[model samples]
Target: MNFNGPLETSALRQVEICDSKLTDQLRLNAIERSRMMDSPNEEVFDRLAFLAAKFLQVPLTIVSIVGDKKQFFKAAHGLPSPYDVSREIPIEDSICRYTLQNEPIIADDATKHELLKHHPTIGPWGIGAFIAIPMLTHDGQVLGAFCAVDTKAKPWTEDDILMLKELTASVMREIHLREKISELEDESQLRDKFVAAISHDLRNPLNVAKMGAQLLSDMDGDEEERADISRVICENVDRADKMIQDLLTASRLKAGDKMPLEVTFGDLSALLHSTVESLQKGHRRAFHFESEKTIDGHWDFDRVRRVVENFSGNAVKYGDESKPIRISVEDHPESARISVHNYGPSIPSDEIDNLFNLFKRAQSARDSKHLGWGVGLTVARSLAEEMGGRIEVESTEEKGTIFSLHLPKVKPSLH
Candidate 1:
């Protein structure tokens, strides 16, 4: 009768701590709204949920959103109606309520539970086995549940749980991005409407600031003051330029217009040394390079350098500033390898899978002083793949972190 034993424990562990009453209310409201939406719609979300359930080979799948009143089925498979017969199950009895509390996929054999054994859906419909995963927004918002049910008892593997969770997370990300795009669209429209008004109002003030700074530089009252003014102007201009570049880069990347690779045989050691030297000048971190053997490999030198720079910069920014960043290169007859090692806090095991994902960052990175847009690793990995190489990271809380790049050694064609 106790199907809740392992299921409840697994689900409870994944629960995110939320103290804000307003946030809780808003989340519940969103769930309710999502649940009311019907299936087989034009919306991409419905198709995604349906595909996820089908791909997982589940008999009954429901995109269930948990609200304060009831668990609503936004999309349902192997069910006659869009809405469940019971609009609201007591939160205590709701399996998805458990999912909302935990991060893992909650799978239970309901045949053993006296409560679920006699339940309306399980008893009459012959639906006993249940599996549910929490669908989460990028900012860690538990939006709803993705679940599958069957009449027969089935054993669930850890891989099954992880795969379902990953699928649900992917769906949630797409939904979140769509919502963001909608919001941005509205903002863009409003900006267009008031473009002339805002521009006219701000242009004079900005021009005055610029002219005043220039006048101060020409006056040369005090050398230090002149330098300070010039620095402020330059810094502001640089900030603006960076913002523009970021926007352009994002657009290009989304459009799959990243720089193309032109692989050629080159000395990786020289390129790595140059990168280290350049980084050392900007960041006051000791950079050490070592090579077990000289390597001439076929690769996009610029792309490889970018990867090295990214890792090195990350080490200097996130690792212990006083500790040295070490670069090592090794070459085999068939392959070449490069590793960047830094003495930093280990990345959590849970985050390793997401490290290379676009816009994904470790929790430690969020809490630390290191600032980034979280796309560096993703870009590096892509570049590596383009050059027929792979990048991997190894880390431990005690030992530190090492990022390694492996590439195939190119052999010259006989003429």
Candidate 2:
């Protein structure tokens, strides 16, 4: 069924009328968090609806949440016809939407009530007496209604109001519990991913080290071959150690502790050059450094190196390996910029914000051949911020991807 646009609320003489698209969207979000839409009727909610109907002396009681397009009857006591079977109705047909302004609606007779006389739930569906208490969130967003309805017009008493209100509170409590449980399940799933990703990343280096050791033992007396094998073993072991160190740094940063740093006067251009040379020795990928002049800043040398290395390592893992990765340094009046650019698929716009978050990875990175625990970027961002710098990224299909670290020329006070 076609659901039309916004339905204007009939102004109530006593209650202030306030409704907007933003408020509606927030209500929808709160409903989503409630996690009640499209769910099969639970015994607890059904019992609550039944209690409301029984106590109020009404034939129908519903715990309904109104969505943008439809109204979902999460729990229904005496709903009739296709609505009872389908458990939902078009948004235009929902009487519960009228109560979304956080106002308790009490209509002794919908046909006589000015606000609801023309409403479809009353006009065509023949709902007479109705009372709905809004299920309001802590932040003031209205999820929908816990309502009772009768076929005959009947005045609601104070006791009926009190009972419905109490049952509505119970419904909200159940919703809050569901929201907490959903959050916990999400956290548990993330933890599982963290463990699996860490195990896969750690196993790679260990296997490399083990194979290198076996090769060294098998090689009979070629000194050059022995030196190369020994270097490989040390590099893999160091790689594993670096991963562990990054993980520790990420944890500390997450705990709101400032990253420990030793600030010293250093040239960013020279640092990038040396970092590139070191990275080149380790991998077959070509890394090019570009700088017109030295850009000096008061920064932690090791921290800067580590951040740049992390960016470049990610470039190798996610970028097109056939093309050379470009590292550029720029000196501005107030700040210096060092950027690592790679020619590859652009990062999706939606994933950019969480790219540096611990245990979060971009879709591109996750799909790549590299197996990372998603901690390197997090540590890099923390180190950059600790050194009075911030990392910026620009990625597009036309220009490729650039991860730039911008640092102030003057050292920032740690205190």
Candidate 3:
């Protein structure tokens, strides 16, 4: 009821005569944090207060977390006069700081105990007797206290602390259980999304192949036209197979599969020429390649080919169709680099970091009409890293976008 702002700790002490009476602000902050990690369930906390109120025979049982400037009532059984078990009380007007900072308290009468007699709540709320146990985490952070209070003077026993301690354990157990359940539920949702993505990605190419097959069957054309139809069918089939292979490769990667040096070694120049030819045949774009005559590498040719195809495909998809997409291979003693460049809208620097993650697409690509499942770069990065190589990207308003893949020029020995 109309909780005011920042009730200065001045109410607790006057002109700071002695410092030992100070509250443990650190422990109080810890208490605030421990409560924030879990969702507050009134029913769960109410049960604690109910149990405490019944066993201790106190009219008021509150599960309190001491905050920076106020005491939060997480759960309460019976509190009166402008309050119940659920209200914020300024720390300066609260007496929780005593037991919360030190050992548990068993105040038989507030008037007798010097520490709590002058407390703002003592005369107003009639807090005659107080008993609280610190609700602690495994690492020993005092979250708050479970306490019982009565209006008339009373006595608290050792057995009361034990009972309250057991109850604190019960409440903490529920908190831990709820937190773990939330994590598992979140993970299950992510798994479902992964399955949906794989299904959609695989289905797209399969649908194209099926349509190509249907068109082929209805054909009554010359050899050239028939060959073109066959090419369409073949390209679709290859695309479908590529999607499946990406899934397979991703699984292997997850399972710790590695590519040996021998597997990656091949003719670098020839692969670039062939990959570009295959891509250009299907797309309405010009492809240009420049490379050393006799390039050698101990790199996974197949993996590199996937990266090349993805990079070149992105170029054609994003670049000016009237202009040419260029592929350049530079050979060095230590390594060889393949760069795919396209004239297109630039990608922002912040977006490049997450570009290779599975299911993550650059904002530029998402905004464009060209759509993809966003796994091609994922495969590319995996393959490159496994082969002891790296992939890099650069984009600008002037030169457009360029993706460069670096691989060892010479193959490593198995031994």
Candidate number achieving the greatest TM-score relative to the actual structure:
2
Put the candidates in lDDT order, highest first. Answer: 2, 3, 1
Worst 10 residues of 1 by lDDT: 13-22
Superior candidate under TM-score, 1 versus 3: 3
lDDT of 3 by residue, 70-103 (tens): 6777888886756553476776765554554436
lDDT of 3 at 363: 89
Candidate 2: lDDT of 286? Answer: 95
Quote each prediction's TM-score. 0.50, 0.74, 0.55
lDDT of 3: 0.73
lDDT by residue (105-174, candidate 2, tens digit) is 8989877776666565574666889899988888898888898998889999999999999999999998
Output the TM-score of candidate 2: 0.74
lDDT of each: 0.65, 0.83, 0.73
Number of clashes in every candidate structure?
5, 0, 2
How many pairs of residues in model 3 come into backbone collision?
Answer: 2
The number of the candidate with the highest lDDT is: 2
